[model samples]
Target: MTGHTAFGWRTFLLRWSGEWADSLPHDEARDPDDEAARRARWLGFPPASQERVTAMEERLGRRMPPSYRSFLLVTDGWRHAGGFVWLLAGTADARRHDNESELADMYEEDLDEDAGPEEWREAGIWRRGLQLDVRSDATYVLLDPEDVDEDGEWAVYTWASWRADAPKRYTDFGSFMEAMYREFHSLRAHRTGREPAFVNDTTRELDARVDEARRDALRGDWERALKTLDEAEEYGRPRARGLGDQIRRLLGRTHLVYFPDVVTDPRYAPELLPPLAAEHAAHSYRGDASLTFPLRGADDALVSQVFATLEQVRAGAYRYTAPGPFGEAVDRARELARWGDTDQAWRTLTDALPLWRPLGPDHLVPLGWVADPVLGPLLTVERGRELLSTPRGGHPGEAPAPTPGLDPPGLAWLVDPGPGGGRGPYRFVLVEGVEPEDLPARLGDEDAEGAALDAPRTLREARWHLPRGPRESSSYEDRPVMAVGRAGAGWSFAFDGDPAPFAPRRFVSPAASAAAGTRAVVVWSDLGARRGESFFHLSVARDGTREYAFTCTDGEIRRTGDIPRALDPDRFFAVPGAGAAAERPLLEAVAEHFGVRLPRHALLNGRLHTVTTRSWTRPPRDGETYLVWSMA
Candidate 1:
């Protein structure tokens, strides 16, 4: 069998009045539009028609492709030497070829062996020769050589012949042509009652699901639309080139109703998503999809990944750039601030001037009219100066001394594991100048009434003082301290010197007291309200367990003491001389000297506590208050 017969003869046939070129019919020179000058030509046909030409499945039944039926309407029959029919099955316009050899390359079989009028007619086969045509039209018809007038008529046509056995089922031109082509096989199927197969399976199922998704999306049934698409995805991987675009579009909005949990589950392989993230960054789209479609795992992931990369770029974290700004600063601050020129040390600070200048003490941005949040205090020039000078070479002086209290019973800052130092939950306190013996009494309950700003007189006399400590000690702190008995993140400390803001109820217990020697009397008031009327009190025991006393007074202070001079101002500290009144005596000293007497005292005894030392008590699982004190 000839190559054409082997594949199946489905050819386009075009006819015109002209001498044939070379051996092939349509290769002859001819006027493209001159009705008389054009020669007949053959075009290509759909694969199903090849079955008929080869007669491979005549018994089982086979169908032609719809493309074949569409091609027959314009096919031109071949007129070759010794009745050798040249097969054709494509449009002169649709198929671009400089010669008949190109057109013949598309022809698939020998049809003359079985080409009877009924067989040809029933199958809607036409004999059309391929030819050069000036018509730029994308569509044209197939021609039957018998239907053509030999007198010469100019016409460009589909090369493939058609053997239509049934009437068209569709009216729309495209649909009609497809339906007409479908008839060629449908007839065989009807008579033989068999299924027909074609090579290169088309994804009609996927297309239907995609179309359904589109319709549902149009109807605002986003969930349903996504579900339909999801179902389609399950059928098989989408092979269409458009699948990538569809995935990206859906991803942008998928967060709204799409099963994100499922979509993001690692089980869903990243390869499952379109590779468009790299391409779509530049591809143009006209609608909201252009802006809304996700680039990577939904746009946010893309953005985060990009920013993370930018962070590396900023500090040259990967050693890509000359140690970036922050890196340079850190290195220079260490190297030069040591034994390097003090002037150069100042100059190093000067070098960082640009970055430091813009920041204000708040570490916010500078503004012309208003403060820039980015250049606020603690970040500004003066502040930077203070910070830079405070710990040059990580020490207080030149020659770089080891961190104090950090090594060999060294001195350390109020924060343990100092700046940028430790993995934390870091907790520490600074109580400079306070004697250890006097600590218990000062924390004890003595002069509780004095702890309050006003003595109880009338309902209107109620006034209170807010506790004071480091304002920087917020719930979230870069440097946190583990206090002996303080609640939440608060800390407990004893000062070696006089405490700032002498009204000592701030950090010290109002009723605590101490003696020059002997035992120290300690008492404290912890108050809090939960839900409603669930008043609470926390007391520091000599062993440091916070004992919680509930149902305490809301407006009064309580006091108790064992050491006589525990609360005596003359013992540990003397009352300020009239001239030293500006010193503002500390209230804790008075509270330790005097005894407290109120329901608030009862409230002080009940609370929760976390043990910072072995002497401290175990923390209760559920409690209203806590207290801790050192018996030593």
Candidate 2:
């Protein structure tokens, strides 16, 4: 009751509320019953009388061990000792595993040379063991009478046929039951979002603090919860570190923590495992079993699988992912690895990591493997240093050095910046029959009182100069700082804008129409913020007529003109009552449809030849009042 691993029958199972009504089967839940099945649902039955315990001991030809005998004194039998083992045998029903001839080969077969002295893992283990569970799932619990300790406590072994691991050995039945209690908590947290909050009455202070910390985490007060749980964990409180792990995930702060259970979610395993494996391998090399315990039962089956996966990945034979930046990069990485250029392979993965995005809530996007297929085998151990050594995602890193010689990914960065800071409320144009250098002169035509382009600036510098007026205050109100570049076969003409009353009628239509001039195809996205603002519009013009136009308001796309056959707005923007959250996939689909990509170095990182478009500002079009402020 006092030690961390203490085992108390009702004390632990009391967490389940001791509500026989709730635990009963549906047929019994409503009708009261004394049926054996119903009695079993109590998770503990009535304590065996002294005469019954003595009779069972005599029948078994040996006295029951003290730990198990004491357990029966508290409760004759127990249920759900482990996740799978459902019905634990009481004194009257307990049977011998040695009596089952079908298990002789399995139990009597040769033990591997390195097999531990744990009785449950050796040849003829079952011959000396008393089976303690009946009618179970995949797990079998055995008490080895031959393995009694000085205190007359029977050694317990729990073998889960579902896992490849050997029967896990516990020094005593009490310790084995305690491990089952811990596993139960893990299952609860994974399935139910960790309900009930408090753990128990014994560690009320720590339990209450952990519960309050969990609440804080639920309220997005992650920093507070993390700090509180960190303190609680120092007391070796149950679930304190586990809850902290969940918070660390929410904050993108899982840098230091590592253990067998380090990767909280399977999706994280791909991104996090490489670094973890690197540390594990390092510890293995140094013979420092501190970081990594000797693979006690069956070779840390999880880690062995991870290395096997890494081997497959390095050999270019892992299962392929969906077509995207990450898949392509992985292909290149594997090729490099195959060619014995592991360093370059690592750099390739790191470079593409910026573009990686998690497939869904299941993944910590951009920080996760893009469209990650599995947990193990995403990265090689040698390459983990590049990923872990480089601090990622929390802050806006300095712009990447210029890569002018390389062609950029077009304009896709406007849609998704991976795990980086938000990139949105975008206003940009795609024009056919134009060059990156020509966008300045074309955009200048849209100037109300003859606009002048500002000297080219980097994205960081350019964002600084937006929401300002020219020295001649009347010259411009919203000077657009833009990175003009080539996108695929057309020219990507993008402009920066502070939030606005989305162009009420079509400020960009005129620009699109003028820029169209009976020859070129121009597409303009005059978008609204994902939150608050409701205005959103996309237009495509060609040969002096609007080819397609649509506005996203009221959770639907209202269109004008014949929509292009190649694009589907409904597929992207048609989330009913989804609010602003629906807009993200819409923009992403647009980028995907056009194969629009922009280089990270140019659009996100280092300086590029960026020009401030001649005032994208227009006056109160369609009776819209724009909110304008200035640092100018």
Candidate 3:
């Protein structure tokens, strides 16, 4: 009565029972009340009076466990799913069950194995037992009365009716009940396709915070809710991290934008550039920038046109010249249309229709091009009515050509091209499937002044610079530095600034670089901050393969498709003569790759500085060394 309130027990039972009922198919759940009653009838038997339970215990010559007694008082038996079994019996059923009789007979047959009380108890050979439940096939849940402890709690076991081995054991009825509850929940979730919210017993404090945050969210105090979730995350609660992401999305702080009609005509696609640029500005940096659209009748021209226009508009220049009367009219109409005089301009165009009427319908200019399948121009007489009567945002009818890869959002990067070269520090937009080209017109109609925009670089040309070591001195020292180059269709690396062949040591391999069509980066480093410099670079292929370029002391650059010694010292040092002083440069390079700072004293030591395979194979005994020098 004090530990678990009746309300809590009822709530749990009702919720789980309701979930079970909902999980049933429509045919089984036609009458909800009848279905619920049938399920409850199978799952819970009539509650047993305390006197009946006591009488059953007396007949069995053992006290029934308090937890089991309490469970019987609530519900005489359980018939829910329990691992490979069901139907746990009550006091009356347990006393007269056939399984109990069979268990007693088995105990009598194994009496010879029960030598003494202590040994029998230790071996779990009990004379008196209660058959709790029978599995679907050949298994039984049993409670051994002879194994009862000081608390009058009998040991529980799961017995395979056919197996000869000792049964799987549980400490008490409470533990058995816990296992049954977990199994029931798991089975319910699997069948229902709906997992109830998990309340962690160990994370009570964190759960309390989460509940408070939910309350805050309900009251529209999202900032406070987010703060609470952050605190929970700092405490290492993983659920808080997911909740935080959901809250950020709900607050519209995510960087992703939804513009499904972006890849339409090449002419009107430039309208997307401003909104995209604004989105980038809002996020500071574009993370996972994507442009999703329907794949049907998509044009590469739209992609190219958008990129070209963005470059030109950012640079304040128009490249394409209007050809013929129709082209000129389109150019003029667009200019006037953008300035909010679309109706008047359409009327003017209608007045001049006689001059361009001879150009034929195919050559007629398009006005206010919307996303549609038909690519011909609107008649001059219909232009005014369509412009003034069309609904807001225009209608997205169909595409002119089939554009693949647009259905799944295409990858794009808005990068700053750095300063100088007459180009302002505007972001250069590069879309993956779009060809680089010059724009026909400025991105927007706004007359901003600047130099002609440069063509945006392709994804392959977007080289990412690797991290460089800190500079300790201003002096120009002849130290080894790393460099990267393309080898065949893949990539290669070399150590520069060494002597003769050693300086330009290069390693090339087809397997070393990323697979064709995948994106990757070439990482190079000098591995020098103060002194004792070394050089190395590697290709981190798109498939996550790290190929190390090992430049030996003898000027031979060996390429190994394995992690270098510096990065994994234990594995590399496991081989004899592998960790020599001459390998220090490669080790230093690997160290630099992993951003490890070596001790200055260790670097200055001459004995430790130069290690070779010879030194490792033939070491000096005691403090003796043989050095043969010839006078030249």
- Among these predicted structures, which one has the highest TM-score? 2
Q: What is residue 376's positional error in candidate 3, in angstroms?
A: 63
lDDT of 1 by residue, 397-423 (tens): 222211211012111121123235431
- Candidate 2: tens digits of C-alpha lDDT, residues 329-406: 877865443222334445676676555554423222233331122212234332332343332233223323322232
Among these predicted structures, which one has the highest lDDT? Answer: 2
Query: How far in Å is the alpha carbon of 100 misplaced in model 2?
Result: 1.2
RMSD of 1: 28.2
RMSD score of candidate 2 (Å)? 22.6
* lDDT of the structure predicted as candidate 1: 0.27
> Ten consecutive residues with minimal summed lDDT in candidate 2?
368-377
The TM-score between candidate 1 and the true structure equals: 0.17
Decide which is better by TM-score, 1 or 2.
Answer: 2
